[model samples]
Target: MKGQHVTITSEWTPREGERYVLGEGPRFVDGQPLIVDILSGRLIDSDSGRTLIQIDEPLGAVAPLTGRNGWIAAAGTGIALIDPDGVEWLAKPEVSADTPMRMNDGVADPMGRFWAGSMAYDNRPGAGSLYRVGVDRTVDRVLNDLTVPNGPAFSNDGSVMYLADSARGVIFRFDVDTTLGDLGPAVEWVRVEGGSPDGMCVDENDHLWSAVWGGSRIDRYAPDGTRTASVPVPVTQPTAVLITPDKRILVTSASFGFDQPQVDDGAVFVAETTVAAAPAARYGPSN
Candidate 1:
């Protein structure tokens, strides 16, 4: 790893009996960094460690990619609009009743399309898939037979997308169409040996920062997937990574169901870095 020494420290810590319970899907909207407590199904304001809204459903991913009226979330088996009024599904998922697929980590492209993935509840192999919801509200299955799908991020120009299949321990890249949300053939990007890649965020310079679940560290990768830097955390599972507006990288950790938890298991951390974040993409009616 070649870079300046970045300072990583805790940003939010739970109370004695509190647990974050799988923190994931972090995004900055209008400068407010919103994070999801996946298990608890709460959208949190990362700045104050407060719950902004509660949706007692399975929250796979939440990002204001549409950049319109309300944020979009993969709630239950489908994606929905969660605003002050209420929640409404834009397009219902076509999952079979017998399948145990649940939505997981996701992101929006520069052209304003939301992409999310799913995985089986029991980590069943080949029971998950990746879906791309276009700005015009059309849902298309981009990839299938995935396991533990996560980290669907893109470069600023939308010419490249980085996706991770956690169960396979690999992150793959695809050439992308920024406007139509088309994915090209997949190619190997990187492989995390010590842990699985969870959520990721791309910086303004096009470098990818990946959170390694169960590895207690976040590694920075160049556009070519070469590791350039890393920041270690105190907990075992760092689930997601986000770059704030001010260039501070914020990390989400988990301690949800552990019998014995580490002190920082449920705490969120921030790293002081010199890289700026790529501007968040908006999802709306493609005009």
Candidate 2:
């Protein structure tokens, strides 16, 4: 069957003087889309269209989080636990680097572990790596020598993991070991030149949906990495994507580094797709 793609337009901007300069992570929380304003360090409620919660200013830019205690977020230096009421506190890992790291794309695994990556500001190769943050706040590096690691989505059955190296324009797949929480024998799942891969999610049928940053569109790929469909956007820097419970797809864009026509262009759009999105996995409780 052929996949369907649609575009939803934005209705509101974030709080005054607020914009998602990086704008990547978007995750479903309690049937509602909860996203992070990467620049302002705010957690936004897609339904109310409000900055529902604000993390402490010291944490740096935050990423959309899904955790057992109702919320989990990434900071410029670490991760944090958030509650339904938007109360949050740092979930500092016992083992982490001091070489100026910030969490990027991440997802909660079937084992309830949060697997996230970090990258340098300039998207330099070997400047960042992937890490696993357990429910106990323990940190372990899974892979290294990565340049702008993003996406970090798992298959429907949790048997495989899909990640992207944006600068290289390649999506990688790895055998997932849930018990040991390890990624093994990684291979290039797909290599799309000319465009960079940003955020992604898996559909109910297990197909991978990736947002192409410079391409201004979202590309759907079969489990084996075949192009299934493409959904274009009006924005130049399309960054992240999320499929709602009702099977609607929402996209967030960035006006960052754009001129007047583009600055007036930042928007959050939504559209319905033929493929149903997989249910979101809640992060396991703090141990």
TM-score of 1: 0.91
Candidate 1 lDDT by residue in tens digits, 63-167: 674435677777667777788788978765635735666778877777778888878888888888888887777778889878898889898888999999989
- The per-prediction CA RMSD against the true structure, in angstroms, equals 2.6, 4.1
Q: After superposition, which runs of candidate 1 have C-alpha atoms over 4 Å from their true positions? A: 1-18, 65-67, 94-97
Among all candidates shown, the one with the greatest lDDT:
1
The residue-by-residue lDDT of candidate 2 on 1-287, one tens digit each, is: 23544333343233234345655577776677766666566767765668866765322223334433455665665566666666444444312654555667777876677777777666667877887777566777778888888868888777889999988889999988877777788899899765788888887877888888888788888887888777777677777777766777877777667656454244666665544675567666434
The CA root-mean-square deviation of candidate 2, after full C-alpha superposition on the true structure, stands at 4.1
Models 1 onward score TM values of 0.91, 0.84
Clashing residue pairs found in predicted model 1: 65-283, 66-283
| True-vs-predicted CA distance for residue 99, candidate 1, Å | 2.7
